[model samples]
Target: MLSTKCPNACIRACHLPAWQKAEEDVKSLLKEKLLPALQRASLKAERARIHNVIGQISGE
Candidate 1:
């Protein structure tokens, strides 16, 4: 068995087979879930910045 503490806690949380499965799960979630959420948040921030710039230009 492999185990460690500190920053390696994440790595130590799984053995070989479990790690492989977890890697796939994490990849799937990042691609299907996290990426979309991040994209939406980024778009919102960009829109807010554009709105702020427009407001400044209009002297509001």
Candidate 2:
């Protein structure tokens, strides 16, 4: 389904299959729009996980 809303809105509102079958342009734009936010959110969690592992390895 073509998103009448913008990329960010589509990401929040669309279901998985609808997003998967979106037009190439929509997917591309969504990547551009959301990639940074995804990285920001993911990086913090990953960093904390790595810290936990390092502490475990060092017997901290």
Top lDDT prediction, candidate number: 1
What is candidate 2's lDDT per residue for 1-60, written digit by digit as tens? 222225543222224444333333343454554568777566555545444433343342
Query: How accurate locally is residue 54 in candidate 2, as Cα lDDT from 0 to 100?
Result: 37
Worst 10 residues of 1 by lDDT: 5-14
Clashes of 1: 0
Expressed as tens digits, the lDDT of each residue in 4-49 for candidate 1 is 3344543322244554554455544545544677665665565554
* Residue-pair clashes per candidate: 0, 0
Question: For candidate 1, what is the TM-score?
Answer: 0.40
| Residue 20 local lDDT, model 2 | 38
Off by over 4 Å in 2: 1-35
Clashes of 2: 0
TM-score to native of every candidate shown:
0.40, 0.38
